[model samples]
Target: MRALVTGANGLLGSNLVRELITRGHEARAMVRRTSNVEGLAGLDTSMVYGDVRNIDELTRAAEGCDVIFHTAAVFSYWGYTREVMMETAKGGVTNALDAAKAAGSKRVVLTSSTAVFGGSDGPKVLDEHAALVEVGVPDYFASKAIQERVALEHAAKVGVELVVANPSLFVGSYDYRPSASLATITGYLGDPLKITYPGGVNIIHAGDVAIGHILLAERGEPNEHYVIAAENVTWREVHDTISELCGVPKPRIKVTRTPALAAASLMELAAKITRKAPLATRALAEQTGRYFWYSNAKIARLGFLPRSMRQTLTQTIAWLLVSPHLTNKQRAKLRPHDDVLQAMRQAQVAQRLKSVRIQDLS
Candidate 1:
C-alpha cells in the first residue's frame, strides 16, 4: 500500500512514516519545505513539499495514495494568536480530507490529542463517548476541538473512511526538537524542579501510538474514536519517576491551582514585557489543575498493548542525553552525574529498535 503522511516531520508523523516503510508501503512524506527532515534520515520516503492548508498542493501530494495519515497541526500555547491557530488547525483538517477525498484513499487516519476531551476531575477514565468539556479550555484545546469536529464532519459528508486516534501525552524517542511534553521532562532534568502543579497525565509511548494508528486504519470502524494511551499518572508521580531515574532531587513544593495560576499570570506578563514566550502560561497552569486521564481499552481491544511508561522514559532520556542538538551546557545541566545519562544510553544501545506494525499482525 502507498501512504501519504502530512506533517511527516513531526514526532508522531515521523514514527508513522517509519512504520509505513517497515510495512513495505511507499511513504509519500508531505511536509512544508522548511520543516526539518532530520528525523527521516535514511528512510526510503518520497518527500513532497506542501502545506496542509493548501488544498491544491495537498491534493497533488495525496494523489495515488492508499491512505492519508493526517498528523499536521501547530502545537503552541504562545508565539501565535488564536486566530492564526484556528485558521491553520481548521484549514489543515479540511484540506487534508479534501486531498484524501480527491485521491480516493481507502482510509484517513487522523492523529488527534486527548486535549479534545478536556479535563477529568480525578481518577475517572474517559472514553470517546465523553462530550467535550468546555470549562477552562485554552486556545490550543479550542482549536483542536474545532479542528477535529471539522475533519470528522468533512469526512462524513464526503463518505470517506475516517479513523480518529486520540493519544495522550506521548513520551518516547525521536523527539527531534523534543516536544512540549518532553521539554517539561528535560527542563526538570536539567535543573531540580522548585515547584509543580496538581494535575495528571496519561502517558503513552509514541511508537505504540503510531501502531494504534495502523490498527485503526486496518480495523477501526469509520466515524469512531479511539483513546490511545498507556497509563494515567499524577504530576508528582511523574516528577518522582524522573527523579528516581535521573538521580535528581524531586521538588517539594506543590502549588495549588490558584497559586499556580497567579504564577502563570506573572510569567505571562514577564513574557510579554521581554517579548518571549512564557514557560508556563495561564492555559498550562489551568490545564495542570485537572487530570488528563483516558481509557485505552478501545484501542487495546484491537490488540494494541503498549509498553510501560518507565521503559518509555528510559528511551526518552537516553535519546535526549545523546542527541546531537544537546549543547554542552544542556548536557551538564541534565547530567548531575555522568552515570545518570550514561546508564540510559547504554540501556538503549542494548535494546533493538522498534519495527512496523499491521504488516506483521500475526
Candidate 2:
C-alpha cells in the first residue's frame, strides 16, 4: 500500500513512518519545509513538503496514496488565538479528507486526542461513548472536538473511509523534541519541588500510539473513535517518578487548585507580554484542576496493548540521559524547585502528627 503520512516529523508521525516502512509498505512522508527532520534521518521513505491547512498543497501531496494519516496539529493550551487553533485543526482535517477522496485513498486516519473528553471529576474511566462538555475546556481540546466532527461529517457526506484515534499523554523513547509529558517531567526534574494538583492523566507510549493508527487503518470501523491509553496516574505520582528517575529528592509542597490557577493566569499574561510560550496557562490549570482519566477498552478489544508506565518511563529517561540537545547541567536545570518545597511540607505534616500524639498523652 502507498501511504501518505501528514506531520511525519512529529513524535507519533516519525514512529508511524518507521512502522510503515518496516512492514514493507510504501510510505510517503508529508512534512513542512521548516519542520525538524532529525527524526526522519536514516528512515526509508519519500518526502513531500507542504502544510496541511493548504488544500492545494495537500492535494498534490496526497496523489497516488492508498491511505492517509492526518497527524499534524498545533498542540498547545496557550499562546494561540481561538480562531487560529480551531481553524487550523478543522481546516487541516477537512483538507486531508478532501485530498484523500480526490486521490482515491482507501482510508484516512485522523489523529485526535483524549482531551476531547474534557475535564471530569473523581476516578471515572471514560470510554469512546463519553460525551464532550465544552463549557470550560481548553482551546486545544475544543479544537480537537471540532476536528473530529468535521472529519466524520465529511466522511459521511463523501462516502470516504475515516477513523479517529484519540490518544492520551504520549511517553516513551525517541521523544526527541520532548512533548508536553516530557516537559512536565523535565520541569519537575529541574526543581525536585513537589507540585500539587487535583487531577490525573492517562498516558500511552508514542510507539504504541503509532501502531494504533496502523491498526485503525487496517481494521477500524468507519467514522468510529478509539482511545489509545495505558495508565491513569496523579500529578504527585508523575512528579515522584521523574524525581526518582533523575535521582532528585521528591517535592513536598502540596499546592491546591486556587494557587495553581493564579500562577497559571499570571504566566499567561507574562507570555503575552514577552511573545513567548507560557510555562503554564489558565486553560492548562483548569485541565489539571480536574481528573482526566480514560479507558482504551475499545482499542484493547482490537488487540492494542500498550507497555506499562514503568517500562515507558524507564526507556524515556534513559534516552533523555544521553540526548545531545540536553547536557547534564542543562538537564539538572530542568528539574522543578517544587520538590524541596514538597519535602518541607511533608516534614511539617510529620511534626504536626508528633504534636498531636504528645497532646493526647497529656
Candidate 3:
C-alpha cells in the first residue's frame, strides 16, 4: 500500500507515518517547508513540501498514493480568530479530498477530533450516534464538524470510501513540542495550586490513535465514524496521576468556572501584550467547563484496545524529564526542595532579563 500523510510533522501525523512504514507500506509525507521534520528522523518515507490549503501542491503530493491520511489542521486552544480556525479546518480538508480524488486514491482516512461532538452538561458517554452538542464549542470544533460533514457527503456522492477517526485527548512519547493536552498537564504538574474542572476528557495514546488510522484504512467501512478513545478521566484525576508519577505535590487549590474564566481573561491580556500564546483563553474556559466523555465501543469492536491513562502519563512524563529541550533550570523547578525552587525562579528571571537584553541589541 502507498500512503500519503498530510501534517506529517505533527504529533499524530508523525506517528501515522511511522506506523504505515512499519506495516510495510510506502509512505509519502506531505508537510510545509517550515514544519519540523526532526520527529520523522530515521523513517523510510518520501518527504514532499506542500500546504493543506494549496490544491496543486496537495494534488502533486497525493499522486500515485493508494491511501490518503488527512491530518493537517490549525489546532490550538487560544490565539486565533474564528475565521482563521474555520478556514484551516474546512478549507484544508476540502483541498486534501479534492487532491486525493484527482490522484486516484482508493481510500482516505480522515483524522477528525472528538471536539466535533462539543460539550454536554448531561454526564453521559457520547458514542458516534450521540447527538452533537454544539453550543459553546470552540471555533475549532465548529470547523471540524463542517469539514467532516463535507467529507462524508462527498464520500457518499462519489462512492469514495472515507473512514473518519475521532480521537480524544492524546498523550505519549515523541510529543516533540508537546501538544495542548500535554502542555496543560506539564504546566499543572507539582503546582501547589490546582484548578479543577467539572468536565473531563477521554484520553488516548498517540501511537494507538495512529494505529487506529491504519486499521480504518485497511478494513473500515465507508462513511463510518470511529471514536478512538482509551479512557475517560476528569481534569483532577489526570493531574493527580501526573503528580503521582512525577513525584510532585498535587495542586490543592480547587477553582470554579468563574475564577478559571477570570484567570483565562488575564492570561489573554498578558498574551496580547507579550505577543505570546496564552495558556488559557475564553474558548479553553468554555471547553473546560463541559464534560467530554466519549464511548469507544465502536472502534473496540474492530479489535482496537488502548492502554490505561496512568501508563500513558508515566511514559510521557518520563520522556519529558530526560528530553534535551528541558533545561536544567526547568528540572530544578521540578525538584521537591525549596532551595531548588528558589534557584529555578532566579534562573527564570535571569532568562527573561537576557531575552530583553537581546531584544534591545536587535
Candidate 4:
C-alpha cells in the first residue's frame, strides 16, 4: 500500500514516514518547498513537494495513494490572530481531503489534536466521547475543532472514509527541533520554570503516536475518532522528574491559576499596543490552567503499547543534551539551574585554597 503524509519534515511527519517504512508499506512525504530537507535525509521515502493550503498543489501529490495522512496544520499559538490561524489550519485540511477524494484514495486519516477537547473537567476524564468545547479555548484549540468538522463534512460528501486520531503532547527522540514539549522540559531542567503550571498533561512518544495513525487507518471505524496518548501526569510530577534526573534543585516559586490569569490578562493588553508577543498571553494561561489528560484505552485496544514516561524523558533528554541540532542558546537554556551555580561556587573555593597551599610551600 502507498500512503501520503503531509508536513513530512515536522516532528510527527518525520516519524510517521519511518513507521510506514517499518510496516512494509511505501511512504510518500509531502513537505513544503522551503523547509529544511535534512530531517528526512536518511529516510527511504518518496518526496512530494507541495503546499497543503492549495488544492492544485496537492492534486498530483495525492494521486494513486491508497491513504492520505493529513498531519499538516498551523499550530501557531503565539503572535497569531484567530482569523489567520483558522484560515491557515482549515484551508490546509480542506485541500488535503479534497485532493484525497479527487485522487480516489480509499481512506484519509486526519491528525487532529486533543487540544480540541476542552473544559471536560469534572468527575470524569476526557475520551472520544467527550464533547468539543470551544468557549474559552485558545484559538489553536478552537481552530482544530473547526478543522475536524470541515474535513469530516467534506469527506462524507466525497465518498472517502475519514478517520480521526487525536494525539496529546508528544515526547520522544527524533525531535530534531526539540519541539514545544521538549522546550518545556528544558526550561524546567535549566533556568527553572519560575511559575508553576496549574494543569496536567498526557504525553505520548511521537513514534507511538505515528504508528497509532497507521493503525487507525486500518482498523479505525469510519467517521470515528481515537485518543492516542500514554501517561497522564501533573506539571509538578513532570518538573520533579526532570529535576531528579538532572540533579538540580527545583524552584520554590509557585503561581496558582487565579493570579496567573490576572497577570496574563495585563500582558495581553500590553502585547496589543506593543505588537509583540507577551510573556504570558490570556489564551495560553486559560488553556494551561485546565487539565488536558485524555484516555487512550481505545488505541491501546489495537495492540499499540507506548513507552513509559520515564523512558520517554530519558531518551528525549539524552538526545537533546548532545544533539548538534540544538542551538547554543537552546543548550544554555537547558543547563540545570543549581548544578551550574554550585559548580561555579566550588571552583572559586578551590582556586583560593590552591593559592594558600602555594604560599605555604613557598
lDDT, each prediction: 0.78, 0.77, 0.76, 0.75
RMSD of each: 4.7, 13.5, 7.7, 11.6
lDDT of 3 at 179: 69
lDDT of 3 by residue, 1-362 (tens): 99989998888987888789888898888888777676676676788887889899998888899999998887787767878977887788777778878999998899988888875775668889865444567777777887888888777766667899999888765567556767756667534565556677788888899999988998888888899998888878887776666557775777667888888899899998999887777777766556789999888888898888876676566556655557787666664334333434543442343111001100
Deviation of model 2 at 231, angstroms: 1.1
What TM-score does structure 2 among the candidates reach? 0.88
Q: Please report the TM-score between candidate 1 and the true structure.
A: 0.90
Reference-based lDDT, residue 60, model 1: 89
Each candidate structure's TM-score, on Cα atoms with residue i matched to residue i, is 0.90, 0.88, 0.88, 0.84
User: Candidate 2's residue-wise lDDT over 62-149, tens digit each?
Assistant: 8899899999988876657899988999899989988988888988999999988875778778889988555577888888988888
- Which candidate number would show the highest lDDT if scored against the true structure? 1
Q: Write the residue-wise lDDT of candidate 1 on 1-362 in tens digits.
A: 78888888888888888888788778888877787776676676778888888899998888899889888888878888989988998888888888888989888888888888987777677889888644468887888878788888898888888888899988666677556777667656654445666878888878788889888888898989899999888888887777776666777788888887898899899998999777778887776568888889888889999877777776667776666546887666553345446656673553444232221100
List the candidate 4 regions with Cα displacement exceeding 4 Å: 119-123, 262-279, 324-362
- Please give, for residues 274-299, the per-residue lDDT of candidate 4 as tens digits: 98756666777765556778889998
lDDT of 2: 0.77
In angstroms, the error of model 1 at 71 is 0.3
